[model samples]
Structure formats: structure tokens, C-alpha cells
Target: MIKRLSLISASVALGCIVTVAPVLTSIYIADEDAERREQEDLQQFAAKAVMRTELVTYQAFAAISDMEAPPGGLCSATQIAQFARVVFNYRYVRDAGAYGGGQYLCSPLSGDVRAQHLTMPPPDWRSKDGYLLWYRQKNPLSNERQDIQIGRNGNYVSIDPQSYVDLIDPARRPIAAINVETNTILALSPGADADDMLNAWKLAGQVNNEQWHYAVARSASRPLGVVVKSPRSSLVGHWPGLLVMWLSIGVVVGGVLGWIAFRRISRQLSFPATLEWAIARKKLDVVFQPIVRLTSGECVGVEALVRWNLNGRNISPEIFVAVAEQNGLIQQLTDLVLDKTLDELSKLLRSRPSFYVSINVSSEDLRTRRFLDVITARLQGTGIRPAQVRIEATERSFMDADATRQTIAAFRNAGHPVYIDDFGTGYSSLSYLQTFTIDVLKIDKSFIDTIAQDAASSVVAPHIIEMAHELGVEIVAEGVERDVQVEYLVQRDVQYGQGWLFAKPMGVNELVVWLSESSSTLQPIHQ
Candidate 1:
């Protein structure tokens, strides 16, 4: 009993150590949560500030646009100049000017000063002593002609004004001008501090570094972004408390359980689980899912998903793949999956030359020269065109954005299509969509699950479809279950659909029959 207790203690300690590494790596020393919360609060504040300021600026510009030439109403050149000056002098406004009939109607109000127009009186003002000379000279060396030099025949260029106004009919009213300025409406928003808000904006902007900022830029009217300027030290400041909480939990429950587990397992029992041993032991298997075309009922592809047979039980790929990855056996495991998947695919390949098979490519495969040569050889041996073979990748593989880009280019150069699996769920989703020459974006099942229920997803589903359409990237919705989900995706014009809605993953013969039946129902009628 005493020996068992000691063994238990050691096993618990080992478990604690193993679990702590990943969890602690996830943890930070400072109060990032608090800082993030603070940042979010500041962003809200900033957004509110922007909206308030923007509305005020918009109103100001609209009012200025409403003003006509002054006799009975707010028209005189002096009045226009003063109004421009006053609007420009407003806290957010940077500069203001007015133009009429190809001449400066009034001096510009830039900074704190206002300069009157040299030719507001027109013909009389144009012919005066310095005026005639001003008209005669190629370019006058005076402040009065600065406007004349810069202004086109009948256009006004207002600098850094509060808001923008453009006259609808410039041909009819030569004096009419359009006013546009930075507006800086977002600066007035309320919420988190500017730094935190900015950080959140930056994080959100970094959405896989795919250049999704253009979306925000296109939707610039929504001031939901922030530029975090806080120091890294500030970000980590609040993490200590959470770390302590976690560590305390670790020391008590985690440590005790780990020590027990380590003690129970004997060294003699921990032999290498060889591939041959696994296969002989019935520890290898494959799950096949059908990929169909969006517009028709054509079964264009089948993705071979590999699963590990563990001690007579089917273990999830998630568990063993991680184990293989952690133990430096990922390459070996990947080879096993690929070989098994391709061998299985070969049975279906002959009848389905048009049928494509997609296998996942790991970072390990991309990094190794041998892996690339092997994949190439396999493709040639199978008589599969480079385009027929698709290599699926996760965001992390692509997050080493530079390497991923080069790898993708190489794959494309070889004629195979590369797809981002679980797309739109990664850090650089937008960036990858924009930067990498990806052929297909397999939308994550998470988004699909919510599509039928979430309003946000309803808008987002169509938006993603439209954006992908713009980029010429095909959108494939995965993990679809219901008829509603399929119908929704079809309506949104998703390019491909895969999930239980069609059929669950099956074996070779079963899949062949399922494919034949599915084809009958989903066949395309070509004209």
C-alpha cells in the first residue's frame, strides 16, 4: 500500500507536469483579460465618440451644403467664407475654403486665420492694378492668387474639412462645390481606452492576415475598429492573478491525479506502436465523405479521412494525430494515412476519373523534400492529374504565412489545388483568402451550424459567399446536417456542399453504392 501510494504520488506529479506545460503556455503573467476588457471598453467609447462627432460633422456639412448664394438668405461671399472658416475651426475640422465661377469666392479658413478671395468682385477685381498684373503674369507671386493657381476653372478643394459635400449639378451651377473631409467621427466614440480598443481592432484586423481590413475599409461608416497603442507589459499585467488561480488548481487536483497515472503505467508496457503492428492489430481505418458540386447533383470528389484503430476500439483522429504530432511521429502517421487513403481511393478512381480525392497535407510534409517527391510520385503512379489531387491545410500551416505561401505556389506550380480546411475559423482567415492563391475555402462546420439560427450568420453567410465570388475563390460549406442548412447554402450560392445531409462517411463498397444512388438523385442535366 505504501509503495502504491508513492507510485500514485509520482504518477499524479507527472500528469500535473504534462498538463501544466500546455495550459501554462496558454496563460500569461499579466492581466491580459482585464486589459482586453479595458481595451474593449475604450473601443466602445471611441466608437461612440466617432458616431457622435460624425453625426455632428455630417449635420454641419449638410447645413453648409444647404446654403445658397446670399441676398435674402445666408449667401454673400463673406458669409460663405465665414461659414467655411467657422466650420473648419470646429475641433475636428482641419481646413475650409469656398469657390464660385472659377474664382475663390472667399479666402480659406486654415488653422486660425481666414484670407478673403482676390476675385469675389469678378471683372472689376480681375482688372485692378495688381489684379490685371495678376491676370497677365504667368503665375502671380502673391497669396491672393494661391487659390487661383491651385483651383481648377470651377472646382473647390477643401482641405481637412469636418465632412464632405458635393453639389449634384456642377454644370448648371458653376459656383456649386462639393465638400469632403476626413470627418474623424470615430475619434469621438465611447468605451474602452484607445489603446485596448486599438489592440482589439488590430487582433480583429489580423484575421489570418488575409487583408479583410478592406471589408472594414469598405464599411468605414461603421467605426468598430480600434488601434491599440498600449505596451506589451500592460497587456500581461493582469494575467498573474489568473495564472495563480490556475497554478493553485494545478498544484492540488492536477498534481495528485498525474502522479497516480504515471505510477500505474509500467515501462515494459510502453512499446512503440509500429504501423505494421497497428495494421496487423486492426488499428488503421479510413472514413470517406462525398463532395458534390453546388449547382448540380454531380459527385465530384471524396475526402479520405483517416482514423486510428486503438486496441480494438476506434480512436478519434483528433486524439492520435495530436499524439503523433507531439511524439515526432506525425510524418509517419501522415504517410500511413495517405497510403491507406490512396489505396482505397484507387478502387473508386477507375470508374470515377472525374472523381477527385483530397488528402490533408501537414506542415511536416511541406517542410520535408522527401515528402514532396513522394506525393508527386504517388500522383503520377495513380494517373491522377495534378488538378485532381487536393491538399487540405489548416490556418497554422498557412500562418507561417511566408512559408505557406511559397509551399502553396509550389503545389499550384505542380497543378494540384490547395484548399484551406476549416476556413473562416482561423486567425488569418481573411488574409489567407486574399494573400494565398487558394482554390477553395471549406467553411467551418461551426458557421454552418449557426447559419439556420443566427441572424449574424444569415448576413455573414451571404457576405462570405459574395466576398469569395469577388475573389473568384469557391466556397464549400462543410458539416451541413439539415435540409434547411443545405437550402440556405444553396440560396447563398455556396459552391459545394458536404455533410450528413447527403450521407455519413462509409467504407469503399458501401461508398460506391451510396455514390451511385446519390448520383441518381443529384445528377446534373446538361443542355
Candidate 2:
């Protein structure tokens, strides 16, 4: 029996090291020196692509904007047509237009092109410059082929007038439309379904709007754009690392199972050095990430992120939390975190009463009656208003719909604010908002990361913000990194933002010093 117990202890110790130790190491001990290096590489690649496309589009528009007009009232229609060709031939704009009052002054890149059963263009057609200016010029009066081929082509394929370009009767209907208000040309996309393209155009700023995917940026005094698309093949490259990570996880699980089987068959003794070290020598620390109000750029709150400080290495939350919960020490850890957080906040709040503090709560805390009693007693004892405390519950915790609803109600009834943290992750059930008393929805960093790119978050993020607003819950964007992300979030009417952009996690003394030094001068990194 003694031998078997020893073996069991060994298995547990090994499991703890593999699972819990990693979490502790990541959160507390991992080398921040090389942190997010891969993510940074990906971000830089994305930023460069976006900037390049933006610059190209800008150049095309600027060329058109800078064209010399003929000495005439409005520059004759032919002159405008020549200018359109010149701009389109610059290998950036898919096509250019200077149409007014339903008359197409220039031939668009693709004339009356059609796709399989549909007359429209593909969403990603302009990635190649080959087809930018391939249309043939036609006499606006009689359907006669003109000498001009609209724009210069590197590989000149003589376009057929009778069968292709000039076949469409200009007098019959307007080919390409233009928005004089925005100076944007509108044409029937050849590769997309005509109905879908029309709907996309009509639904500007809405989901699947092609215009949202392509940006028109100003560069060198040109109001044009270049569309740079990363092939799906390249996006597929991210899968290898993810696959390796998952496979490593599977191997770890198999090792634990094999160890369990071996221990069941033949008992052996091994020292529980890892667990002993973890329980006895482990030090707990907290990192403070600033949460700022978007409009005023004022630091309103700080989230206390727990870190497992190992003697020589920092442990990750991923490993420690699992082990802590499995070993039923989560409550103890929570108690420690709560005390540490409140102790720090007590001083900060004494000075800034309006200042708030947010702390994460485990599902165990919600289910346990003693946890509530403990928190309530502390709140009463400390004289901290419930409104000043923000409880962040993960999406996974809220998956237990009944318990989450009950806990949320209990906290809100006691005047405490409950927020749905990591908003876009796990189960994003709209029913949670309807059933529970949620005060705010914190957008996950993944969504915030893509705000600069705009297309990915332009519709989805706004929908989330709008939905939260409709429910009277404030929206806070987390992990904001750049000025563009901030600008985009503010434009989307997000009320609060938090991330490295505002401030890194600081110790109590450092935080106080920072607040004193820059309380009035705190501004968004851009401003």
C-alpha cells in the first residue's frame, strides 16, 4: 500500500510539473526578453502589406488628381477619358472614372465581363496589375473603334472591338456609374455575382462589403489605393505551429496515462520534489495593466493579473490554474489574489475614490457560499463601495448558464459590477446578456489586434459593440496596441480601452509614482 501510494504521488507530481509548472513558468518565470517575437513578426508583415496597398491606391488617385486639364470649362469628355486611361495605366487602380450625370467618360478595366452564370468581379481581382487597363477605347458617338487602346499594356493583346469592347451600345445604357460625392467609381464586378456585388455596394460599412476589404489611402497627394491581398496559402502557414503545440499536448496526455497504468501494475517510490517545491517555495506576484477611458485618456482602473513567481523562473497561469483547481487549492489561491489585490487597491483608492479595480474570479468562487460571505465581509470591513470593484468572469465560467446567472444576480444585487471578460472567446451566447446582469463586455485582444486592418473587425466588432450598447452594457476594448487600433475603436464608439498602449503592469510604489507624475498629462500614445 505504501509503495502504491508513492507511485500515485509520483504520477501526480509528474502531471503537476507538466501541466501546472508550465503555467507558472509562463506567467511568472518565462523570458519576457523573447516574448511575442513571433506575433510581432506577423504583425509587422501585416502592417507592411496594408501600408504598401494603401500607398499604391493613394498614388493612383493622386496621379488622377494631379492630371493637367485642357483649356476648357470642364475639360472635354475626351480629355477626361485620356486622364482616366493615364491613371488606370499606372498599375495600381483597377480602373478610373470621371463620369457625371450617367455618362461614363472612360472605359472601365473590364467591359461587360461575366463569370460562371453571374456578371460580377471577384473580391480579390486587383492583386495583379496585368488586367488593370486592358479595355479598348471606342468613339462615344458611333460604335467605331478608336486608335487608342485606353491604356498602355505590357503584353499587348489586340482587343476585339466588334465582338468585345465596342459591342456594348453606349446610347442604350450607362456602363459604369460614379459617385461624384465621393469621387469613387462604381462598376459591375465581373467575377462576383451581380446581385451580391450590388448588395455589397448598397451595404456600405456592412458585412462582406468589398470596399471595407480594400482601402483607398492618400499617398504623395494622390487619392487612390492599391489592394494587397495575402494568399490563403500564406495564412495556412500559421497552422504548423498550432499543430505542433496540439501534438505536444497530446503526447503529454499520453505520457500521464502510461504513467498511471504503470503505477497501477507495479508500485514504485519517487520523491514529490516538484509539488513540494511548488506548494512551499512558490511566490505569488501581481502585474497591473492600466485600463483607461477612451474619451479622456484617463486611467480609471487597473486589472490585477496574477503571476506565479518562481525562484529562478516565472510560471504560466495555464499550468498552475489547472493544477490548483484539480488539487482544490484554487480557493486558497483566489483568497491570496483577492487579499493582494484589495490591499494594493486600498491605498490607491484612498487617494482616487473614482478609481476602480478589476479582478478575475474563478467559477469555483461563484459556486461556493463561503466565497460570497468572505468577499462581502471584506467589502464591509474595508469600506470599499461595491461599485468600485469589478469582477471579471471568463466566458468558459459563464458556460454553466444556471450558476453564472445566479452568481451574477447575487453580485449585482449587492451593488457589485460584473463584466463578461474575454468577450469574443468561448461561448458568446446572447442569452447571457439577456439572463445575467452584465455591466460591461470586454472585447478580446484578438479582435482588437485586427482593428487596424479594419476589414476583419469593421463589421464584427461594431456589431458586438452595438449589441452591448443596446443591452445598456458598456464596451471596453482590451489589448489595444497602436494609434490606428485606438482610433478605429473610438470611431466605433467603444467607451473604454486597456493594454500596453496605456501602461504596462507596475508595482504599487511604481504605480503611485506614475500617477503622481503624469496624472494630468496622461494621453493616448498618439495624442
Candidate 3:
């Protein structure tokens, strides 16, 4: 009896560890990821901050370059006008002029009438170009905040110190730019103090999470540094809840069984690597969302949307597609989506000749002719027309305009209607639009949501519609959920629409049922 009790006790303890351990370990890894992401964000901010500061310095140098003492001298109307123009041209500079007798002889700030006396401190350092830099001194023209003054020959420019890190959002995170040599901060956003800045610099490239998480990133171009700090993320709140649930499961199961469950859970948590494996195994899910013709109130086509369900966690196409692209499995994933769409919808598409299924392709697909060739080959064996299997690409896919244009031309020549999805959301101009000949432009859902709102962006939808009309491309408004939007689009002669208002995305069986429900539209072509 004593031996059995001891064995039972050991088994229970071991079971608790085998199951709960994976959950705890995953949470720990997630916490570490949060900190690492924050550090990366800080690094990006530091680099951009340094670049902005460099831009400010270069602009000042350009404005004051080739500046020599004219016969009219420092206070001449021409010289004053030149300095005034410098102030006007350089967005970061507040004061610009030639220095003489230890005072700004004339500046745009002081007017052309009199010299501005600036009781500035001695220079912190002199550059190789004989330029003296005052790191920080009281702003003589503006508020009490300090300003950085750069002087060369008889010319000088006063720069607003905040311009170095003006792009930093104080509400999001506190960041500071410091002179690496002097360890003096040129400027700091709200929520950070001198102590925080100095301490972060001391622990540069190291992480600390006792009171606050902080990172210090240095500039490669100059002797400057940036510091950013964030509190523990809100994900911390989820730990306790998850711990309780996993612990209960662990205690109920034996050690070996618990470990088996743990292995599966870990695999799900390891989404990126599993995604690669899933693609090879052909475990991806593809659903269809119909695109409806507005005038007839009938479903004319469907957009093939890729989806993934791993242990009840449905991975969106946006994520899995990006994973595939990053891992060089994009063409494979595209093939999978294309083949699956054809496999499921070919019979239906053949029976209804005019109905189309739009297949999405990544920017990577446009880099080569592989995608077009693959689709053309697939359509040859099947009785389906290339026109019935349309091709849809986002604006980014057209980044390599010439290469993508040729691929698009190939697709068009093969009878596939090419569509530019998410228009007006990416880099836009008449150049890219006219450069590529497309059959349709799908205005992004974000613009459609603003159709009747009182916001300034409400006007963007109309402008996009007008632009598409001017370019002679047919318009298809996406995410049309309201009757008001439908009426608005129809009034402008926008031909087609896609979203939940007509029909939500459905499975292959569900879509077949949907088509049967619309009996008039589902009549067999040959019949």
C-alpha cells in the first residue's frame, strides 16, 4: 500500500510538469518576443531619428554653403534676403545669417534693421570643415528650450533642437537623441528625463525589465545616440489565465499523454515553421467570396481567398501568404491556391461559362513568368476558359512595372482578365496606372467605408472613381456592406461590387449550394 501511494504521488507530480511546462514555456517565449520587438522598434526609431537629424544638418550646410562676404557686407539687403530665403527654404532652420563682431549681423528673425545679440556658450566641438557646433544653448528667438547652432566661416544657422526627434511620438514611446561624445541630450520627447536617457546610454545594447524596458541605439553616421523605453506589454495579463487552464489539463492526464498534447500545442504555437511544413503537406484551406454584379443583383464571380486552420486557430491569408513569400514557397503556395480553386470550381465554372473565379498572386509571382505559364498550362487541359479564371493582383505586385507588365500582358493574351486590387492604397500615380493595361480597378474597402462619412477621407472614394474613369478602366468597389455605398457606386457607373452585403465568403460546398439557390444564374452553358 505504501509503495503504490508513493508511485501515484510521483506520477501526478510528473504529469503536472509535462502538460503545464509547454504552456509556461510558450508564454515565456512570447514575453521575450515582445521585448525583442520593442527593441527592434527602438532600433528603427533611432536610425530614422539619426537620419532626420542628418537631414537637418545637411540642409543647413546647403543653405549656408558658398556664402562669402559680399561688397555689401553682412547686413546688405541682398545678403539679408538670401538669409531670409534660407530660413524660408530650410524647414528645420529658424535663424540664418552671416556672423560678424560676435553677433548675427542680420537675420530673417531679427529683421534687416538690426543685429541680434546671442549670448551663446563656447563650442562643444569643431568639425573638420572649420565648423563650430554649439550642442545646446538657450533659444534666443523662441521659447526657453535650447537650440543647436552651427557656424562656418562668417555664416551660421540656428536649428530647432526638437527637429532632431520631432518625428518621435511621445504618446507611443519616449525617445531621446544624445551627443555621444558629450553625453548631453540634444532633444527628448515627453515622458523621458535626463536620468532615463543617461542610464539607457550606459546600458546600451543591453535589456533591463525591472522597472521599465529600455533600449539604446546608436547612429552609424555620427557621434549620436537614441534611447527608447516601454513598460511591460499588456500580454502579461494573459499569462495567469492561460496558466490556470493548462494546469488543470496537465493534472488530469498522465505524463506520456500530457506530453503528447504538449507537442501538438507547441507545433501550433510555432506557426511560421509549421506553415512551411503545412504547405508541403497540402494542408491549406481555400474559401471563395463571390463578386456580385451590381445592376443585375447576381453573383458573377468569386475571389479565391486562402485560409489555414491549425488546431482551431485560423491563419489569415495575409499572414500565411507573407510567410510563404519570406520562405521562398510563394510560387508553391500560389500553385496550391490556383490548383485548389480550379479543382473545386472547374465543373461549376464550365457549366456557367460567364462566371469567373479570380485567383490572387503575390508580388513575387510577377518577378517571373512562372505564374502565368502555370495558370495557362492548367487551363489548357481543363475545358474552362482562361477568361473564366481571372487573375487579381495588388498594386505592389506591379512594383517592377516592366516585368509585371509583360506577365500581365501574357495573362491578358491568354484570355485572363487582369485586376488591380486594393487600388489607391499603395503608391499611386497616372504613371503606374497607364503604364499597365488592366481590365478592372478594385477600390479598397477602407475607401468604401468612408463613402457617406463627414470625414475628409470620404472624398477619396469619389476621386478614385473619377481617376479610374479618366483612365478608362472599369471600377469594382470592394467591401460594399451598405445600400448607400451600392447606390453611390451604381450612380457613378461602377459596374461590380464584392463584400458581405451580397454574400459572405463560403466553402466549396456552401458556394455550390449558393449557386443552386440562384437557379436563374446557375443555368448550364451547354444546356
Question: Largest TM-score belongs to which candidate?
Answer: 1
Clashes of each: 63, 34, 0
Q: Candidate 2, 20: how far from true, in Å? A: 26
Residue 242 C-alpha lDDT in model 2: 40
Query: Residue by residue across 239-281, what tens digits does model 1's lDDT show?
Result: 5774566556766676665455445433312423554367445
TM-scores of the candidates are 0.55, 0.50, 0.51
lDDT of each: 0.53, 0.54, 0.75
Number of clashing pairs, model 3? 0
Candidate 3 residue-wise lDDT, 214-277, digit = tens: 6666654456677777666745567778767666665765456556766887865576678878
Task: Give the Å shift of residue 111 in candidate 3.
Answer: 37
Q: Order the candidate numbers by TM-score, best to worst.
A: 1, 3, 2
Estimate, for each residue in 356-405, the C-alpha lDDT of model 2 and write its tens digit: 88878888877645666667888776767777777888776776778778
Residue range with the least summed lDDT across 10 consecutive positions in model 2:
161-170
Best prediction by lDDT: 3
